[model samples]
Target chain A: MPALVVQWIVALVMLVGAFFILLASIGLLRMPDLFLRMSATSKAGTLGAGLLLVGTIVHFWDFSITTRTVATIIFLLLTSPVAAHLIARAAYFDGVPLWEGTRRDDLRGHYHTSTHTLDSVVRPAPDTEIPEMEGDDFPEEG
Target chain B: MMLDVLWSAILVMLSAAFVLAFIRLVRGPRLPDRVIALDLLTIVVMGFIIVYAVRSGQAAFLDVAIILALISFVGTAAFAYYIERRV
Candidate 1:
């Protein structure tokens, strides 16, 4: 590849990658609701990173970066849906209402509050902040 | 020469995905929100890795890329499992 052509290619790819990242930010900030936002986050991030990684590979073409980028994409593909599912499940279990336009919530009746326990990690940020840790004694053993 | 053009084009498309994902990552109202973002971050990193491989002409890095892809899945899975199974 000619130096001029390579330089042009690098510049173009980088610009495009940067633009996509910015767009994801916009979607994150502007989206109206949680599910919608999560949708954007998962799909957008995956795509954006994929582009950037590919760009890096094209520009640098090293073992470390190539491995890192591919790993990144594959990881995103595997986990994004799983995490989304968990979050959605948690939201449903804890009684977070879906958007008003939503027509059905089948899980509401099927999975009662009694069946699934709500862990803090699954919980969204609560309105009131928890008080700071107070003095506590260590456990004693016989 | 032509290979480089195609690769660059792919990056352009990937960039779009990155921003959209970032948007959601930042605005998510729950724990999974951050997890989702982090997950996306890994993907974007992967893209760069691929691109770097092309530019630097290091064929060996592909192996590392594969490993990263594997580990990231595991990391995400662990979190998912914790969220699903934890008391």
Candidate 2:
């Protein structure tokens, strides 16, 4: 393809991608309900980031980068939903409460409430040490 | 070349969808709402990437889209797990 034509095409791609990102941010800011908002944010953010990076790959047009980009996109699709699900579930458990007009909470009366205290809400247990980062702090190694 | 033009049109449409989704994200009332909106943004990003790949005729560009999708998913899952944890 002519260099000029390629440049124009890539530029347009970038332009559209950026607009999508802005929209995603807009959704993050405007949604009214917790669950609905998360749904919008998760999908839009993932898609927007994916689009931006893809534009980068196109602008470069190299095979190695292409492979890497493809892998990343797949990864995004795989993980985005799982994380979204976890967050939604957690928010519900933490008693964030559904929107005022919610007609139903499917989980209501369906699951048993847990008795375990959630001390790990903000930080992990101090005794649960991380691997390797323990470094010379490990007396045996020292 | 024909596909390129067609895809550009598609991209424009997707961009509009993105705007609608964003309005919802902003109006949300809680942290989860924000998080979810962020996640949705990630998806819209993926679509944008695809359009780039198609428009530039750089099929390889799809690779970045794949990776972004994966990394963001991990971020969301970790956050969710943390919030859901009982102890």
Number of the top DockQ candidate: 2
Candidate 2: where is the Cα deviation over 4 Å?
Answer: A115-142, B1-75
lDDT per residue for candidate 1 within A5-94, as digits (tens), equals: 665666566556645655655565566665666676566655665565566656655577657666665665666677667666654543
- DockQ per candidate, 2 decimals: 0.23, 0.27
- lDDT (Cα, 0-100) at A55 in candidate 2: 59
List per-prediction Cα lDDT, in the order shown.
Answer: 0.58, 0.61
True contacts kept of each: 0.33, 0.46
Please tell me the interface RMSD, in Å, for model 2.
6.5
Candidate 2 C-alpha lDDT tens digits along B4-73: 5655665676676567656655765555665565566556666766666755667665666666666666
What lDDT is reached at residue A53 by model 2?
59
